[model samples]
Target: MVFYGVSNFITLFLLFLLPLHSALPPTTTVQINSNSILVALLDSHYTELAELVEKALLLQKLEEAVGNHNITIFAPRNQALERDLDPEFKRFLLEPRNLRSLQTLLMSHILPSRIASHHWPPTHLHHHTLSNHRLHLTTNPTGAKTVDSAEILKPDDVIRPDGVIHGIQRLIIPRSVQEDFNRRRNLRDISAILPEGAPEVDPRTNRLKKPAPVPAGAPPVLPIYDALAPGPSLAPAPAPGPGGPRHHFNGERQVKDFIQTLLHYGGYNEMADILVNLTSLATEMGRLVSEGYVLTVLAPNDEAMAKLTTDQLSEPGAPEQIIYYHIIPEYQTEESMYNAVRRFGKISYDTLRLPHKVVAQESDGSVKFGHGDSSAYLFDPDIYTDGRISVQGIDGVLLPPEEENEDESSTPIRRVKTPLVKVASKPRRGKLLQLACSMVGSFGRVCS
Candidate 1:
């Protein structure tokens, strides 16, 4: 009887596990054909759209749709999705809970029937989408083809036997999707607000005191320079003496730590010396950090620093000006700088030197700073990054274009002689001589 009971228990457990095993996906996935329009869409220049489709888990659905009949897809150009799209709306669509809305949005871009650019109707025509939403087809006043409000930039961009893709200038969002996003955003905004007293400012620091704990990496409400106590010059104010209450971060310690890191980082001793022994700006920089201002230091290596002429450093506040030009009042890592250059081709950043900006561009797969002969490559990236302070080492010193132009203009030019072209007929010397002779003869003096 005991053996029979054990057998029964084992049988019941096996029965419970059987359904789960059956629910698992089959060993073989339905292979997508190389020539299918769906495959073309995935492999075409519409990479951003393809990524979103994949993220929305609509690949299988698209595949199924393509398998049934011919279809057309209106793809938004990468720029439209990357730069022109509303960031909050994009966020709303990408939320996991709003998966249905995302699916509807993507589906609204596709039509059941293949409609090429040439086949578009002259008059307004309404068609049903894969999401069963109505899309109005028409042309603009200039005769540029348009779907709803977005202009078709590239007509029949990618054509396969199964379907066609038209690139649009912007994403054509459905009204339903817009309403849904607005609703979600409103709710989020309401929930994010806290019932707190008026903001307080520290008299010494001149920074607004946070009522609650701020998230890591959050930008300060005020500009770094604004946080400085009233001062006559652009130079950083002397660090406050330790008497009042301290903030969450020990800005002084963080500054010291990074300076130590620069010393140990092998190629950056000159930069360390400038921050520590060479100047008192380091103390002020630490105060800025403690007041919730971040900084990115573009440190020139020892070799680069050695190239600086004595005249460049001999002037009053010259060293401070040079260092100020290198320090950006923001926290940026290697990945962020590289990404910015890669995306925008060129990016400009404001530096501590008021009104001067640093121009960065993508060069040989790295961030190149400054311009012309004075440019420097980001050689040692992210040498130090501790949420508030960031340091990047470079192979060459960076100088502003104005300063570079000034140096070039100041260089002594060697004098050279050339055969001069007669200008203004040499002031009519022959005529003048004739007049002189006539006047001298009349005056009873012999003409030479």
Candidate 2:
């Protein structure tokens, strides 16, 4: 016990006498003002990348971005590059096919806004990079670490400036995300054919003609918003302006305004900071509405929207159909609807000005607007908004019926056939004949 205590004390005394400079980073905080740091990085032992970027003029751009602009640089080390880069990517950058690849490679490291390692939110998130699209810093669900999915030969090349730059093991590009966007755009789906029109189908009977529909189950798909108000805030909502005022609106600005109004009316003005980051599909939305294209929007409530991801809303053409579904062709309200049991009959209606059918029904005591899955209860019958469209809330996601899988190559199901046999029995036959005769009420021919 005395020897062990002596060792610990000796270790502590040695640490106390050690030079502080060798024991820690110079400072936990740093300040940047001149070109000294960049020069020092160039002169540092990490010569391979520094040499390549020097030849490529990467340093020139870095100097420009960092000139008194406080940049954080993630500098990579020589051994780190050899240790971290993907073998295939390393080969591609060295190849001769791509010329503009170097610029892409360098720009991938820059971000428009300064983001220090400390400022990085400790949560899973998708962030836009300096290049406008590529380089999403995907933090895992645990949020303990982050990566760009591309090689960072050396991580955390600390620099005192606007932001940090790490020497990436290879160049970064936007091919994967770009390709995914294309694939989603091309994939086909079952769409409702309007009796009169839909881009995917003929205007005749409105039945599917080619590329037959799939079985989507028996649920009736209907529009979901009761009212188009932004959120349930008590703040005064934006009045639906006439077409002229709406036409000149900056799409992003309009959405922000709508969000603010919704928050105010919903009594959530305290969340104004969050409203500042709101997004809009307004320009596209306006185009669809102006062209008289039907739109229905499945807006996730604020609770739902907060958890929404890029996977949910990043598709380029998604806003079109989504907006179409939200719009009913003409205004519809419960008071204007025919609810009499005698008047219960199927009638075609318009959504975004396109023809659709509303199945009407009446029971022993109640009136049903639509049966089964297609049912929509008019929570607020005359809830009028903007005088352009009427609003009603619905409980579940409404969609067309699930159809049978009609792929031709599949085999038919087998069924067992019954055999036929006749037996002669005098006494039993007499009873069978009587039974048959009993089956015929009016005619006594069988008994005769």
**Per-residue lDDT tens digits of candidate 2, residues 48-97?**
66665665566656666566454544444565456555444455455445
Candidate 1 lDDT for residue 345: 95
lDDT of 1 by residue, 1-448 (tens): 9999999999999999999999998775556689988888889988999999999999988888887888999999999999988677788888899999999999999999999999998989999999998888887678899887678999999999889999999887775675566446434543664422323457778655655445532455556666554333465544432212435455786787677567534568888888888777788788877656789999999999999999998887788889888999988999999999999999999998777899999999999999999999999988777677889999998988764554466579887999899776456558988998888788885433
Q: Best by TM-score, which number?
A: 1
lDDT of each: 0.81, 0.42
Q: Count the backbone clashes (under 3 Å) in each candidate.
A: 0, 56
TM for candidate 1 is 0.42
Candidate 2 Cα deviation (angstroms), residue 108 = 0.8
Q: In candidate 1, which residue pairs clash? A: none
lDDT of model 2 at position 372: 80
TM-scores of the candidates in the order shown: 0.42, 0.30
Q: Pick the candidate with the highest lDDT.
A: 1
Off by over 4 Å in 1: 1-218, 228-244, 403-448
